[model samples]
Target: ISFNAIDSALSSLKNCQSYINSGMDVATQVALDLVESFNDEEDVNNMEKVMLEYATMDRELNHYIKAFEETINQVKREKPENLPDLENLAQEKFLEMESKNSDLDFQRNEKYMYFKDQLKEMKKQYHGNDTIEEIDEDIAVTRSQMNFICPITQMTMKRPVRNKVCGHTYEEDAILEMIQTQKQKKKNVRCPKMGCSHVDVKGSDLVPDEALKRVIDSQKKQ
Candidate 1:
């Protein structure tokens, strides 16, 4: 599904590029015609105006081409097989952190509470009156936080896949493997997400989440 969407977007970008090239060609021809139309100094001024317009359009075209290339490269990089086993890596990290000291868990929880309080205070400071701009800003921040990491992997997702049943997202291969392993164990493949109420999740519940994948890619670039 995501591959098809990427292909469609690429095709559209190519068509737009071709159209821009054609427009530049037409502009160039018009500039040449203006050059031959008159010998007066006024003709020189007109030619200069045409040239400036052409330059502006050319810059815009180049910008779009560069953007398209970046998008294609991002999509290619987000292929599922290329992503690391973030779930296993995160588990290893957790085990190492725990083995070093049992107090680490308490410290982590305390830090989470401290940060949550700080965030609340900041939000109150910035959004005292709950104005439209403040509300929009808050929404944007919440959305960004949601897309920044995968719940199961506890890492920034490369190729995100959505669980349609519960509207949760995870790294594609991680979720698939989880589902397969759960199925082999002969247990209900419920969502592994904490606090999620979803049950009886199956492999078919997962879908390639292209929008989330793009968001992840964009966040990584930033």
Candidate 2:
């Protein structure tokens, strides 16, 4: 259960990071869009203010991600008996990440008001001038092809399950069957990966890795 909590925390952290990166990218593009609308000194000053706000938010998000990573690493090193305490710590960090996300949203809204006002003024000045052309900044993100493969079956994973203890991933049915087989022989269930340190793994040690599943689905579509 503690390992599951740790995995949950890790997933949350990754999600938060993805959000922060996307938000910052959008913020930067918005600033660029504003800058392209006019060349006036006042407009540039307003754009700088908006960019500064985003920069502050970016820094905060980076700090939070770093702190969360450190915390997870520390917890991973702790003994299995200490897992309950680790779960509590993970929950606290998740809450803190949510709070930071809220703070970033507030800052974004506040800065946007100034940005909107500046845009309005710019429109007045360049009413009939050539409109700014929208730049196509949508670059496709490339993922590792290996991520779609199941470590156990060495094929594309359907219904992927992530191992909470060692962060390895596998096909859900394959891992469950492995657990059951071990149980029937009255032996402890351990990770099948050679040289993997994880031991005494149970059915509860696995969780659905939704992110990986999404990636697999997307790749299939393409």
Candidate 3:
């Protein structure tokens, strides 16, 4: 039978006990007397068998009651008045993560810009006098300094991807495309002259002056 039916039966049996003790319910007294006689009899039935059944039922009833009580307590704990809105909590956490990401972006950009400016200045000062070897060495040093800044986002790259063609690596796709694409049909488009032998750094490398000029031209034409 169902738990509710069993519970109801047990309750009724308890009520019957009161009536039996008062000697008011003849029916309940007869039933009780018959059960007691089983224990008193020498050969009718074993008392141990009845006691084992009672113990097993009692344990099962205890488990059901404990389970029901736990469920009620859990419901109370999860009520609107007691618990916070999970969606709102998740939104707040997301905003917190975004703020942290933004802060990192800002700091990274600052460092990257500083190094880029320094490299540009060095390039301008040493323009056109050195042999291929010296120029390559200087370019290598400048590009190495750029490692401090992210090439794509102009932030300090946490995980930087280097360009196979040009030695210059950036985190942004726009910059990389500009560097890889030839500025004009006449000028040779290639990765940075850092002796890296990168054929074409289209992936994430910053576009050189040639690509920028072509972009400007394309924009003008449009």
Q: Rank the candidates by lDDT, best first.
A: 2, 1, 3
lDDT of 1 by residue, 46-112 (tens): 6445544544444444445455455455546675566544445444544454445432332233222
TM-score of each: 0.35, 0.36, 0.22
- Candidate 2 residues 67-94, lDDT tens each? 5666668766754554545445655775
Badly placed stretches (over 4 Å) of model 3 are 1-91, 98-194, 208-222
Winner of 2 and 3 under lDDT: 2
Show pairs that collide, candidate 2: none
Worst 10 residues of 2 by lDDT: 135-144
Clashing pairs in 1: none
* Winning candidate number (lDDT): 2
Model 2 segments beyond 4 Å from truth? 1-146
Q: Residue 26 of candidate 1: its Cα lDDT?
A: 54
Compared to the true structure, candidate 1 yields what TM-score? 0.35
Candidate 1 regions off by >4 Å? 1-145
Window of ten residues with lowest summed lDDT in model 1: 135-144
